[model samples]
Target: MRADSFFGKLTRTLTGDPGPTAPQSGGTRPKDLRRARLNDAVLAGESLVGALLTDAGMARANLSGADLTGADLSRARLPGANLARTTLVGARLVGADLKGAVLADAELTGAKLTGALLTNANLSDAELTDADLTEANLAGANLTSALLGRADLSGADLSDAYLTDGHLPNAKLRGVDLAGVNLTEAALVDADLTGASLTEANLGGADLTRADLSGADLTGAAVFEVRWTAGTRWPDREVEERLRALSQEVEPGVWTVVGDTGRSRGLRLGD
Candidate 1:
């Protein structure tokens, strides 16, 4: 069909407008070709709730502030797309390619993003509470101050990712690779990090209350001023003793380690 016709259909569907529909004689084009057309036609701030945009090629498209709740965008290519503050609750983005996309402050609660490629993506301050990101590639991504409470990131690659002050309470990061990551002042309370790799990671002033680090690697990792409650599980007795030696009880069920620098590099524990 002509570009004009294709855009008209997309516009109607995106806007939820009622219009006359005509069945095409021939079958739709291949997913790649059709997706390219849709990509070219997707406008910013449009409502695409429950839209079926599977395998859409939306690289560099501007979709900021769009409502995409329950949308099926599995395997869609959206690298470099502007999706800031977008509503994507419960969206199916499994295997989607969102590398380098701007998703700051976006709502991704309960979204299925298994195997999605988010390398170098900017998701700072984004809400990913309860999101399923199993095996997602987030290497070199900026997730500073992002809320990942109860999120499942099992086996995900987060090497070189910036997660300073990020919230990951009760997060499941089993066997995930977090080597050399910066977790300064981040909250990882009650997080399950069993067997996860944290080699050379910076955990300065981070809260690890009740977090499980059994069988996890912390070789050469910076643990200065890190907060650990009595419920926190350590990898070994040797490491635990060393950490306790550096820490001091601040209050009931609260322990901290004072840092040898400016800025309150000390850890605190409560609730």
Candidate 2:
């Protein structure tokens, strides 16, 4: 479990050239793969079979299309890595550093990403259903069209994240900081947002049906075609009155409202 042994194995695996002292394939040898220091390891398109990478540093590594399913990468440093289309299902990445990484179309179902740093990461069209991202830093991340259904994002920092057309149904977002996030046309049905901050967030045409916003801050939020119920809260009384006055029930369980009082009428929801 020495830190240097893990890095040596990872280097040999990435380069596709086994070193002189490297262990043979399918051997019963116990390699020390814990706390590996593998900075800039090129593991793209490689198949990592149940590798132990706990507390490893693989920053700026090229892991595109790498198979990391069931890998133990907890507390790993993977900042600015290219992990596009990588298979990370059931992987443990708790407290990992993945800032500015390209994770587009990656499969991260049931992965533990708690307290991970994913700032400015490109996660567009990624499948992250049921992933645990609680308390993670996703500031300025590009998550457009990503499937994050039932993901745990409670207390996560998502400031200025691009979440346009993303699916987050029933996701836990309590106390999350979503300032200036672009959630246009996103689906957030039944999502929990108790005490979440959405100051100046662009939620135009987003679906928030049955979402809990008991103490959320939505000052200057764009609400064009946004759906909500009677349980949804407004930060101020004046804003609540404005919303009530502007909202008009157009159909059963559906309401309509005007955005900026333009010529066209927007949409909302009703209880």
Candidate 3:
């Protein structure tokens, strides 16, 4: 973790501590800084722990509140980077591009970010506990109130993502596509999300308690006041017997999906 090079453009006379200076982690050893260009680098709150910065270009870099714990930043481009509240615990950032990156409240515990692009990234309230983000794209990402416990995010895309009030307990999210995601009240406790797609997803007031939505998908997903107890595992038994025989429970853990269901029922179940 001792690679560094100026190459140029960290500026304020190439980071001799003028434009922004916070990196004082003992007798610094940085050398090599693979592919270092450091475009727009400000290096805010810089510590850059375990820094190597592989392929660093750092486009629009601010590095806000930066610690960059265990940093490698593999394939780094860092498009529009600010990295707000950045710590990046156990960071590697495998294919980092971070398009439109802000990373609001980011800590990114155990971060790897396998195929990170993070399109339109903001990552509101981001923590991403045990993060891996296997096939990450995060289309239109915001992830409001994001914590993402035990995060894996397998094959992630998260189309039209906002993910309101996101928590995502025990998250793996296998085969994640997340079509039309807004997730107005996302919690997703005990999540594995086998074969996840989440078509037309809104899931207003979503809880999904004891969640295991087998063969997951919930087409035309509004699922108003969605709570789901009795160990929820739909997408079987004729779509939970046609959502308990033609979905209607105006109160008490309301899960309504009345119309526009059949197109082979583009389901949006979970785990």
Each model's TM-score?
0.85, 0.84, 0.35
Taking the tens digit of each residue's C-alpha lDDT, what string does model 1 give over 1-271? 4433554566466556564465335633111122443554445677677767888888888889888898888989999899999999999999999999999999999999999999999999999999999999999999999999999999999999999999999999999999989999999999999999998888988899999999998887777778899898888887777677667888777787764446334322210
Q: Is candidate 1 or candidate 3 better by TM-score?
A: 1
Best by TM-score, which number? 1
Which run of 10 residues does model 3 get worst, by summed lDDT?
Answer: 1-10
| Predicted candidate 3 versus true structure: per-residue lDDT over 1-271, tens digit per residue | 2222232223334355352254436534343366678889787876777777888798998989978788889889999889899998988998989988899998989899899899989989989888999998999889899999879989989989998989998788877888889887789877878778788888777777667778877777766556665567776787676655444565675554442445313334331
* Model 1: worst 10 consecutive residues (lDDT sum): 27-36
Poorest 10 consecutive residues by lDDT, candidate 2: 262-271
Q: Which candidate would rank higher by lDDT, 1 or 2?
A: 1
lDDT value, candidate 2, whole model: 0.82
- Give per-residue lDDT, candidate 1, residue 168: 99
For model 1, state the Cα shift of residue 78 in Å: 0.7
lDDT of 2 at 52: 83
Please state the error at residue 154 of candidate 3 in Å: 20
